[model samples]
Target chain A: MARTGQVKKVGTALAGVLTISLIAGVVFGEGTSPAAPAAPIPPVVAPAPFSPECQGGSTEIVTESPLPHVAAALMKRRTVRILAIGNSTGRRQGGFTRQIERLLKQVVKGADVVIINRGVSGELAANASLRIKNEVAMSNPDLVIWQVGTDDALAFVPLDEVRETVESTVRWLKEHNVDVVLAGLQYVERVAQDDNYYRTREMLRDVAAKEHVMIIRRYEAMQFIAAAQDAGGGYGPDEFERTEAGYNCLAQYLASAITVGAFGKGMSARPLRGPPGSQPQQPPQQAQPPQQQRPMQ
Target chain B: MPRQSNAIDFWRGIALITIFINHVPGIYYARFTHANYSLSDSADLFVFLAGWSLRYIVGVPDRPQQPIGYLVLRLGGRAVELYAAQILITMIAIAMLAATATILDNPLLLEWHNAAAVFYDPIFTHIGLAALTHHLGYFDILPLYVVLMAVAPVFAVIDRYAPNWLLPISIAIYLITLIVPLPIPTWPVEGQWFFNPLAWQLVFVLGFVMAREDGIGGFVRRHITVLRWLSVPIVAVSAYIVWNRMWPDPTLMPQPRLLFIADKTYVTPMRLIQFLALVALFSATYPYIKRWALRLVEFGSMLGRNSLIVFCVGSILSLAGQITRFVYRGDILVDTVVVVLGVAIMAFAAWLPEWREQVRLRRSAQPLPAS
Candidate 1:
């Protein structure tokens, strides 16, 4: 009996030691080092329009044209088009697509900014590829703003699949001469308490870089707004509205910049400046002759 | 035999009730639901109890073949019943999805149909393939239980003949699972299954081994005295550990590498200790709780005796509650009220058949006494 009791005590002690050591080893091991104060994440910055002369191409100005004369000619010749494709969040009436469309209409006015919103909610990038040709390519879009990766993240899509799908989609779009603007995923702080969303966003950024496509940096913008709201106090109905508005502003900023970059002097003359208080004012809007707006067929 | 005053059923009922509430999303308390106390955990607890009860129902040493066969048949029948229940629930879920998609003008089905290729990938094709080798979802526990039961006979033999070896074997299995890497491909990702059957088997087998102890009653009596004193400190320590583990200083994030062990997968050594400590702490106090639990268990056992009927009815009621929540969107108060009423109706349904049988038995036995 004494020997048995001693053995039990020894087993208990050994269990305790083993458990403690294992925990210590893990807690003290590689990942646990105090994350070096993350280099302060740079705030998202809108791209500035380049001067027409700096574009390394011939510049032409058509006067009293219903569209930016240069862009009007390009549109008549069927040159520049843009497509927005994503899930339901992208398709909402007041969602990213509408905001981008409104911004394009305002900025490029008569430049024939054909913005198509082909967003189906809950659809991952994998499915988007299936219908890409008919829905996106048929328009012969010169630029495609891709807002995906959220549904894929929520659905537990493997990181590699996410990378491969985005890569293949980018390759396909580029092959068809469509300039790709990979829209980074919005932050899902609530569901992503486990850091899954952050990981997905990082992967998306990596894909954008690897594919050599422009990135809209929506993830950073959303995180910025979310953090600002949190700092100001707490979440409320108004705050949610403000966050949505901020996301819209982000979409507008990215679309306008990419459009200006792609079409150059052919881009419309509307002010690139957002509504008052939308973002930190950076540069003065360049002046151009007003052009009449025409309804898109 | 009269229903034993086993608190096991009460605990089971509580587990089920908690799980029912946890599944009802958008509740005020929804955010607080953790892996330890959710449906998967409840299933784990149920399996452990099933193993324990198997030993209890069959004699410890060598039981008669007839009784053994009866027990096996009962358990197997229960498993079959569960499978049928799962199939029914799946159909109901599909119907609910359809209705919600149509009435809410939601594009959920359209989206699902469009993404069928991604959604319909075989379980093994995904990460943690071993984990997803079984169906992927919150409702896959029944299949796991069925698989576990097929091996229960082997476990029964060990329980009956080599009881002392059970703990060592279970410990060895758990340690191996901890030390060795088993990457089970799961849909969308590769990781271990939620329950980590290898690690969890220890608890089930421990329960089985405990049920066979000859001096359980005496042990309870003695432990009850010590438990009253020890429980306070144990609880305090447990609480402390939980707080420290979950809410460690934000500064610790920089050293995320160091916190790799904090991950719950693989039953990390700390988590194993914490969970075992909780179980031991709770078990030690059982004697004091037994008096009240005994009576409740009698009530619960009466319901649990026909658990299949109760489980099926309970699941349907729970589904109705979920559908109601999905339609209503936000009204947490209404959701809670409806769920509570639904649970009551299920309990009553579970009770009626057993009550009627009891009455019939009493009447039949009375006539024999008069004769």
Candidate 2:
């Protein structure tokens, strides 16, 4: 009798487990896969033309290599998701993330652009690297625009730690078939002479070159803009006001640079079609001769 | 200070102190925290202990369970309190940052710890803050606690009616979440919560389950020696992995990648498992700890007993510490001063209420001295 009761209890527990699993399965399994993406809508407005003040220093906008995955996704699916990580991406009015989305839509015509802005304020590169991996797993973004170096530089993090973290993370992203755009430190006039600041910038430049990824040379662009503004007249605005304008110009530059990187060899080879509102175009910027791809050790 | 100090409270106090130290990012002492050596940090202990404490609130074996409606209301009230606390402290933290920014004339202070949104997009960010959709870094855990508390009644109902089904149900939800990307998304910023409650609920449930006298609790107590022995290798190996920073790449894992990686956001299986093992291994050390460090044990217990308030004050103090460190350029001396002062204040914050309660108890026992 005792043995029979024990068997009956075990049977009951097994039945309960199966019932719960089935219920949970039915509920969660229904929406595990996202809805099939809608057909691409033709962009109604032309890509925002580069602000003339934001223009110039054409070399700063160069893409060293193509973002093959972004290009492929745009070709095949007509949709691409870009995860923007860093402290600086969260400027007042949706910052560069919104600008990129708008520019990509206008630039690519029918390609759908989704920018997942995962920027946290005061985040260093080493910390962002960890969060970037998980965000990649969850969001499955085709490209990541990492606004790195600024916080690390300010925090006085060692250059080697920054390099190792960025290099390893970039390699990891590449291995996972995701493209990366390293947006280097934001330029501030006061920090121009700081050794740590310069070292962080140099480190990022090195990582981008070493990893064979496109880098947004924000420092060089901002520096050029600052000099042009100063020569044109007095210091353009107070430090705070200039920071805001700097962010706007950064958005414009990044939109152009990222679009160029995505379209890559294709953009250079074809006769470029200018957006309706912009001047009849030359290729967005002087494209760097493509570097030979090297395998990461 | 509370007239009694127990192991759970002592451990909680230790976790609180660790959290306080870790929140000041550049503090030299931060390197010495359990996070440096363990896969699971104070967060795991804090959340697990939250679940363990929930067992007391819901019911005890010897005490009659409160009426179901009253129980639900109690949990709801607690959730409200936590929510209120989150809003209050977040506001104060922002104010502190803003004040520091103004005093120093450095606008960068406004950007620290995801506070830019609160200033930049105040209207939407305030709405997000109130709705618990936007959270600041290092100040996010409470929102998760509020959410877990809000759902406590369901766990209670399940435990009441089908006692055996609770853990299985929690596990099912956890597994389903692992397979499906069902994280609660953040708003006003397109992202997921830093602490995904769905994945984290399992640890809380495990804590609750293990705190009870029957089921898993009784089983654990009975075989604790053997389990402790088994946990030794998990703890030792995890320590080595963490110390060496041998964490695997999340993207390299197969589908349901979250399950394989040692991610804190999702409180992945590896973290959850290691946390449990660490708990198992450490749970036996209370007697030894009391023997050698009774003063430390008492201090930790006092802090643990008033965790919510201490945590709130500690959060503000840590933010202040961060600002101060930034201003001073964070040398050893700056870090030392920030840490020492911040922790000293936290201790006082914890002690203040207990002291008040003790006075109240003394007055009540004095048989209305004025009359």
Candidate 3:
């Protein structure tokens, strides 16, 4: 018994020494380090005014003709900051934000565009809505592009609940004098099957119209692209929306809308793709004079 | 079962509850779980404890006096039950998602968690799911568990005859998988399993090997007090590491980001070490905790006793909570109600088996006057 006790003591001591050394080694070894910086998104060249992807103006500018706040910042400061918040759509794998920045750089001469991503994959808009206020306050971007409703649509969240969350969030953004842009859902083949997908899309459109904020017509443009794709042999057989090409196209559409909205009718006095809900025709022949988009405030 | 009152069951129950909340995306109560404050979360704990539980069934120093074939068969039977459970639960989840999707008129439900592939190509995907090549989101861990249990007997036999080489061999396979980065691939989506068994088996082996009282488990048990002291700083530093998102960035680390990154799929070394340190510390303090705390052991013990059943129900209930949060606006009150009701239901599910056992004991205690 005495020998056993002595052996146990020896074992305990050896174990203690070993553990202490292990802990010390780990504690000192590779101590806390920071997350690697986000990949540098190279600013590339701008797309043509009417790429196959751009339809009229993919986004209908909601704030009055001149985006005075963004314009003022761009013209005087030659710098504009945009906060892109959403789910997987906002943080596309191909660096959609980089494409947007490059296009905006082309649109605004000698101007610097800083776009920040505030997206979490698989995050619901309801959750995003709760967190947006803090993000906006921290980043204080000139414009906030909120990609919403896709996850909610997928999660089986109620339509009214979706509307209420969005409508109220938009109201808060507007009240804070943050120019809000509601980017709609991604269009996919499955979307055709889901009634709530379009229901959520329409609700966003209605909210944008009601609040008088700009919204990128992402779903409609993607639908147009998907239809064009079905006509055969454009961008391979992959789901157009899931592909990198789809995200780049989206970036082009959104960038074009922002440029048109920011610079006013003077630069491109071009005709839009079509008037809101007009005949399904091609781009207007002449660059008609656009609204004198000064800020409503 | 001399009315076992170990901390394993209690911690496992906690892991179960935490997993249930975290599985439900966008739940208000999720942030309160261990993941926010640690590199490893409840999943790590659950898997580790799972491996530890295997030792109780069959391992050196305390293995049951059963024939090797019987042991193999017993483990095989468990694997079969788990496989069946996986299929049944997966189908139930599908039905639930389908019902919600149809009610809300959203086919997008099929898209989340790669379920869209199943719906889009049901015949093939169903075949894949049955064959254990495909797994659904939030319903994945069980498939991994099934694989581990199936593999346990081989390790158990090796453990009985050649314990020294068991862990080395297991670690070698783990490291090889990491180096080659081999993972069991999933179908229809063209991705690998979320919890890669190749990588996770390391934790399982470590847990099992460390549980044997004649080996490291004995050493640790003997030196638990000193190790517990060492764990204080380990836990403190780990908390800071997690909160600050501090770790050697995976990209900066040498080859194989799987080994370097803080990932759930691979259970990276950083997460593994921290979790081990945590278990070492926490397990040592279990006895003292009971002196000062609530009936932490009793409720969790009951739930832990029937962990598998409770887990299945808990997972289903968690989905229901998410749907509830969606259907009704998510707020403090709504979140509170969901969590409260969810826990209550889990408790009832856990308590049912225990209640039945207690009633049997009471009846058994009654002297059979004529027997």
Candidate 4:
């Protein structure tokens, strides 16, 4: 009985030691390392030329940010892998990934753009952050286009939770050498007056700025397009039909945004105006005249 | 005769209730569910108990003697029934979403829970939905259950003939899946199933092996006290891990990373092991629960007896609760009302069939004068 008691004590001590070791391993693990090392910045190049189908005259769809990995992949292997993720907005822009691939191919003269869409409907930012890790493990993309904020606004997820989840996920991605572009909310009629919606959008903008990544500023773009078309009397009776058109136009804008983000060089670190009266963080850069654009192939 | 309230049914009923609450994404009560603090949630309990319950149908000694072919046919029919239930609930859920969208004049409602394909790409989405390749989020588990039931006959065959081989074969398949990460892909929406059946089959097999009276199950029953004592730290540490949200980065992990992560879709080793420890620790609670609250035991057992119908009803009610929360902005009062009414409706759903069965039994037992 005494021997058995001694053996039991030994087993208990061993288990205690093992547990402590596990806790230590978890506390000071691989994730503690800082993301975004000081790698030399790639030289800027001309933004990929837009397709004739892309509209919204000279609107700066993406703010100035460096996509060094995408540029390196394009330069060395002539290939870039992109993952489009987030809420239902990822699905709303039909065939936008194909358009991005096509435009990049046209511009880079043999670029192989591989895009995978992993969008879940009505997913909040926190949940999407978890899924992003799983998908990155599986897909190994060089760039992640995250359409965010709208669902969180609608679901009333805490603003702090949104910020923390997005910031940490963005940092995690950067640490793993993946570039990110945050696509902000859509401009739906129902949420036009929602303070939470606007705040969530602004919060996302702040996240992009703090992270030093580009944001698509989708809400501002959509708002500009809506105001321009309405003033020009381009309305059919069906507003849903206009939403479809808006999504199509959004596709073009996203494709352009990806192009500018991947290849645009020497862009000042400033936001640009989409149309007159739309929000811009800096003095508007004059949009190149329509005549300057290359005609559609 | 079977007891009015058994551990299996009571625990299954508990799982059903927990699942109902958790399915409502942002409910006030959602924070109170086991998911908030445990590595394994009701889904694991539901699936494990499902495997445990199947031991009776697999021609064990305690079960009445039945031919293997009959058992196979019964299991096949059950698989078909689960398939039908899945299709029916999916149609109802879609209609609910569509109705809400039209009533609110909000197209975004149509986009909720991966229903965009059904609205925008109806032709292919319908085929995908019917084939069980397309599933709405929070409405997915039935497909996994269907697959498990479909394969149960094969498991039973192996278990009956070579009992020792069943677990090792299941573990081999699970390990292979984790290494290769060969998930069952979703159609019409380039993705994978939320609950990957290949990796999940191991849990089911474990539950089955532990339910039997020979080999593993008998050994476990004989040594349950020691196992329970050993499980305490595992359960405690896992709860701490979940509470503090200490998840390892999947990307930094070595190859065969699915084996290391705490992913629910693949049901990783951590989750599986923690869940088994949880089962070991909690397996002793039912008798105490019965002693303290007999009414609760009876209520849970009733719900467990008609688990399929209750689960289907609970799932639909949970979706409705989500919609309710969305409409009302999810305060404490709204959550209370949604959960209270939803659970009541689910209980009613469970009771109705049993009441009808009892009625039929009484009529059959009565002597007919004219006939």
- TM-score values for chain B across all models: 0.71, 0.96, 0.93, 0.97
DockQ, Cα level, model 2 = 0.22
Docking class of 1: incorrect
RMSD in Å for candidate 4, one decimal? 13.5
Model 3's alpha-carbon lDDT is 0.66
How far residue A62's Cα lies from its native spot in candidate 1, in Å, is: 34
Looking at candidate 1, what TM-score does chain B attain? 0.71
User: Which run of 10 residues does model 1 chain A get worst, by summed lDDT?
Assistant: A1-10
Candidate 1 Cα deviation (angstroms), residue A68:
40
Interface RMSD of each: 16.4, 2.8, 9.4, 2.9
**Top candidate when judged by TM-score against the true structure:** 4
The full ranking of all candidates by DockQ, starting with the best, is: 2, 4, 3, 1
lDDT of 2 by residue, B1-371 (tens): 36589988889889898998887775678889989888899989999999998998888534547987899899999999999999999999989888987876666566667777787778988889999988887898899999999899888888877778999999999989888867787767565687889988998999999998878999999999999999999999999987886777677788778788878878989888889899999999999999999998989999999999999998888888877776667778988898889889989999999989889888777865554
Cα misplacement distance, residue A88 of candidate 4 (Å): 3.1
How do all models score by TM-score? Answer: 0.49, 0.83, 0.63, 0.84
Question: In candidate 4, what are the lDDT values of residues B227-334, reduced to their tens digit?
Answer: 999989988988888788677778878877787778888898989988998999898998899999999998998888889999999988988988887777777899
Query: Rank order by lDDT, top first?
Result: 2, 4, 3, 1
Model 3 reproduces a share of the real contacts of 0.02
User: Candidate 4, what DockQ?
Assistant: 0.22
Error of 4 at A263 (Å): 2.0
Question: After best superposition, candidate 2 residue A73: deviation in angstroms?
Answer: 2.9
Better of 1 and 3 by DockQ: 3
